[model samples]
Target: MTKEFFTATPVKQVFDRIVEFVPVGTEKVPTAETCGRILATDVVAQTHLPGFARSTMDGYAVRAAATFGASESSPAYLEITDTVQMGMAAQAPVGNGQAAGIATGGMLPEGADAVVMLEHAAKLDETALEVYKSVAPGANVVAADEDVAAGQKMLAAGSRIRPQEMGLMAALGMETIRVFKKPVIGIISTGDELVEIGQTPVPGQIRDVNTYSLAGTVGQAGGIARTYGIVADRFDALRSTCTRALSETDMLLISGGSSVGTRDLTLEVIESLPDSQILFHGIPIRPGKPTILAKIGQKALWGLPGQIASAMVVFDRIVARFVGHISGNALSYRQHDRITAELTRNLSSVQGRTDYVRARIVEDQGRFYAEPIPGPSGLIRTLVEADGLIEIDMNTEGLEKGETVFVTLLR
Candidate 1:
């Protein structure tokens, strides 16, 4: 029996329909080992940073009023009380008409509000010093709570931990950090003419590329790839593998059988599963229009295109975001970098579909230009030659040369 093509849904509307039926759980990990992990709870400061006011210059610490009207012509003199040792408490208080020698980062003595740089003051004698510049209160001094205040919220939940966040947690003496658990994504490729990558293809058979490539992309998005070796197009075999995959993984991806074909059996098997609902059967997205998203139980079961290039584009643009969402990260999470550049060529597009044009970015005379790398979607050389993809809006018909656009980088 043959089937007709279904109405295509808009990409955003399809993406908005995704619900996290099984959200990733959280665990406690060492703050130092939390790089790239999404924070599960908000972080608040435990104590004031620095814990004391300190000087930022190597000079005399004195009251701002004591240095008033002090300049090269006429100098204000104050008695030198004591010297603050490095990494030690202030030696003495700065009484009226009194100054204390302080090094950079030295603790500020009581009654001292500013530091006069060494070059701005002169040592007249062993007990007296001349200030050659006027100073304002709080000048050249770091307040006790300047870096962070106690009880202040520092980091928000759902934030990814970076090297700088590690340093901040260290500064705040945070030992354990709450982070979302890494999600486990299942991958399955269905095609009778596909062979393992280890085996060379003979005649019409081709090497399986989607399983391994999708695994790498899944890892980049913080999900553990649980792969089920290539399954044939038979309904029984594919359904058996998917049953085990969904049982073992947070999400299952059936690569192939999304488009309407005699061999396209993913929709039928997915629909037969208990409590399965096909949220979307097709999307108005160029290069990956034959995509299917079904909710099987509480897990997302995706039927991706069988073509190598189309499968990869769908994973990069659509699948990765869903992985991030289930893992408690932001919905629009993307692994590839994006850059803004001027288009060097005019590009045409259909009105009802969003087009992702592969492009090569080049730098000339300090400015960057995005040059279109035009080719059929199935061409492997097109993926190799392009550094990024330029997205044209579905509402627009075309883009003009010299128009600025954002390119989603693949390399």
Candidate 2:
């Protein structure tokens, strides 16, 4: 079948369709290693933070009524009854006109409504001090559950655990956390003209670059990638690998064969699987117009572009989304920001197809400028020199120079 045999769906639509087949999986992992993992359940605060009313600074804890109108000329004097210890409750309650020396984080004594810092007070003897500063009720005190209330819901389900999330879990004395399991992805490259990178390339044969790049990309998307090596352009070998990979993994990715003849055999291999159905045969995307997607039972099998750059772009935009959704990390996940820049050259794109133009970002006069890199999409060097991608609408004839546009960063 020719490329005309299939109708292409937009990139965004393809991703939305595939995610319907993905199911959430859960695993219990240690909190120390939970960074980047998605939460499977809501995290509730087990106890109140601080657990008791405590001093916020090194000061004297006294009844607010006793410290009223205290000043420099005629300072209020109070007897220092006791000293509060750290991590322990006050030894005794403060009586009227009496104060207790309390350090930061020390438990506040009963009957004390405020704390006056040491800088505002002077000790005449061990028993009494002249308080020059007046403190209002409940000043400089951290009440029980002030930072966090007991049974309060903190991190919710589908939240990606970050450093701050881990710190919150540690505060609750949580050593283990329940998070979504990483999806297992099986990668297979198929072509007769492909050879390993270490070997010298003969006539009509090129190095296999798609497998390595796709595998690394899968890892960055939070999937466990298993590269099954390059399969020969025979129907039997390709079928066998697809069957085996589908049985072991949640998803399988096959790099399409470049030649017209080999592409038919690859399609036949997918057709042989039980309940296998093609989702999309061609996308209206440039360089990656030959991409395909299929579902074998519950597992997803994707046919990526033969060109290295095309394959990576389609995978990052389409397949990576499904992986993140299944892993339950979609809520807090975000793609790299689009860098604003001025286009260096005019670019043309076909209607109904979104074009990704690779460009190098330059800093001139404290402003960012995007200069389009000139090369065929198949060449790997185009991406190596690109700092970002400038997207053009399908309906636009061409984009003019000096036009401010958003360029999605490669990082």
Candidate 3:
């Protein structure tokens, strides 16, 4: 059966529809293994970080007023009562006309409000010290709760844990944390001309690349990918695979048979499933217009293009977004990394469709320029040779040479 799309849905609208499904459940994991996982609950500080005032330098802990008018010409001298040891409480208070030796990260002695660097002071004797400079109150000392206060929200519910966040959690004594479960995605490659990667293909056949590539993409998006092997384009075989995939995984991705053709059975199989509804069959984006999105119950199913580069582009922009949403980290969860570069050549596009042109970024005279990588979408080398993608908006017909453009980093 042949199908025609009179109108292609906008990319933003398709994303909106994809996020309508609820997110998966959460589970508690050790904080050490929580890196790159989205937090299912807010992490609040139970105790103030650095719960005590600490010295930031190896110097004398003193009252700021005691160092007034102390200079090299006439240095002020004070008796050193005791030395503050690392990880131990101060043994003596810093009284008037008295100084306490303190090391970096040592707790400040009582009545001491500032730290004077070692270079500014000289040891006149074992118990006496001379000050050459005056320091203001609170100088070279980090007050209690300066880094984080009790009850402060350290991380939001949807925040992705990074190395620094893990350190913070460790400081707060959080051994385990609740994080969103990784979504399991079932990937099935459908085509009669497809063969396993290990097998050498004969005439009119090609090795399967989409399954591995899509699986890697799923991992990059923080989802677990389960390959269902390649299925023939026959209606019964594809439908049976689809039914099992939807039941076994949180989402299903069927790559191929999206375009209208005599062998196109993806749409037919999706429609034959119980409680299945096609959210969108096509998108108004170049190289990915033949993509399909459907839902069966609470699970999502996608029909990606057969071409390697086209399938990857659709997966990166569309499938990744939905995966992030269901994992509690939506597209807006973090700022996208982008750089502005001058176009090395003019890029032309149609009026109605948005274009994602891959380009190799070059630096000359400390300025960045994007050189377009020209190749068919079916050629995977086009993406391999490019550093990032430069997008042409739907309203713009083309971009002239030497124009500045934003290059979205592939990572």
Candidate 4:
């Protein structure tokens, strides 16, 4: 069946489209081991934080009214009743004209309203204190539930647990936490021209670059890759491999057949699956325009272009975004920073295809300069020398020197 293709969708639209079809999955894991994973559920406080009115410093805890207006020249002296030890509840309460020796984080005596830090007070004896600095009500103290109230939501579902979240979980005595499960992805490389790496290439055959590059990329994007070794250019063998992969993985990624003749067979194998439907037959991006997307029931199946650099770009842009959605993690590309630069020379691009030109970024004083690295997309040196991509807008004629434009950093 003939299928209609779309002009390249904006990057944002592509992301939203995948997210609409995906939902995060759940897994129970120890909170101690949940670092860097997104939380599956909100973490609510089981009990009051601080749980008591506590002193914030080592000094006198007294009625704020008794110490009001007291200063270095004329200080308020109170009879020291006893000391409140840290981590132990105070046994006695304070009253008028009385003070309690409170250490940092000690439970406050019932009638004390404020604590004077040790730096601002002098101890007269075991029974008396001379306060030089005046303290207001609730000063140098933490009220009950000041940090977190009982049953309050301390963290929300989908939160990316960081060091602070781990510390909070530790403080709450949580040894385990619920998190999203990692998605499983199956990768298959197909081509008669492909041979496993480490084997010397014959005249028309090349090393199996797709399997290793794509497997590593999948791992970095939070999915476990199950690789089915390179399938020869045969319909039955390819179909059986796809069947096995679909049965085992949440998603199947087929490196597209190298020659145009085998492309139809690959699609036919995918279409034979029950309830399978092709989503997109092709994309409108340079070097990767033969990309295909499909759905077998609820599982995603993707066909990537055969060229190495093209395959990597499509996977990084589309497959990685899908993985992030299902795993509840941010997209894998480095955070983008935009800077303007003068084009060193005129660059040509197809009017209808969106192009990602590798460019080197340089800084002079505070201004950023982008110099385009001209090479075929398949060249590894293109990426190695590039700091990031210079997006050539679709329908634009060309870029001329001295025009300021935004270039995104690869790092």
Tell me the TM-score of each prediction against the true structure: 0.92, 0.88, 0.97, 0.83
Candidate numbers sorted by TM-score from highest down: 3, 1, 2, 4
Model 1: worst 10 consecutive residues (lDDT sum): 1-10
For each candidate, the alpha-carbon lDDT, in order, equals 0.87, 0.83, 0.89, 0.79
Number of the candidate with higher TM-score, 1 or 2: 1
**Model 2 RMSD vs true structure:** 3.1
Tens-digit lDDT track of model 3 for 60-167: 999998999999998988889989999999988999888899999999999999999999999988998999998889989999999999999988998789999999
RMSD from true fold, candidate 4: 4.0
Q: Please count the clashing residue pairs in each candidate, in the order shown.
A: 0, 0, 0, 2
Sort every candidate by lDDT, greatest first. Answer: 3, 1, 2, 4
- Model 4 has how many clashing residue pairs? 2
Model 1, span 216-325: residue lDDT tens: 88898778999999999898998899999999999999888898877789988998888899888888877889899999888999999887678878888888888888
> By summed lDDT, which 10 consecutive residues of candidate 2 come out lowest?
1-10
- lDDT winner between 3 and 4, please give it: 3
| lDDT per residue (tens digit) for residues 304-345 in model 4 | 877777787777656777876777664333445667787777
Candidate 4, after superposition: displacement of residue 316 in Å? 2.5
Better of 1 and 3 by TM-score: 3
What lDDT is reached at residue 293 by model 4?
Answer: 80
Distance from true location, Cα of 204 in model 4, Å: 3.7
**Stretches of candidate 2 exceeding 4 Å from the true structure:** 1-6, 64-76, 258-264, 332-334
Q: Per-residue lDDT of 183-271 in model 2, one digit per residue for the tens?
A: 88999998888899898999999999988888898888788999888898888899899898998898999996632452567677778
Candidate 4, residue 366: CA error in Å? 5.5
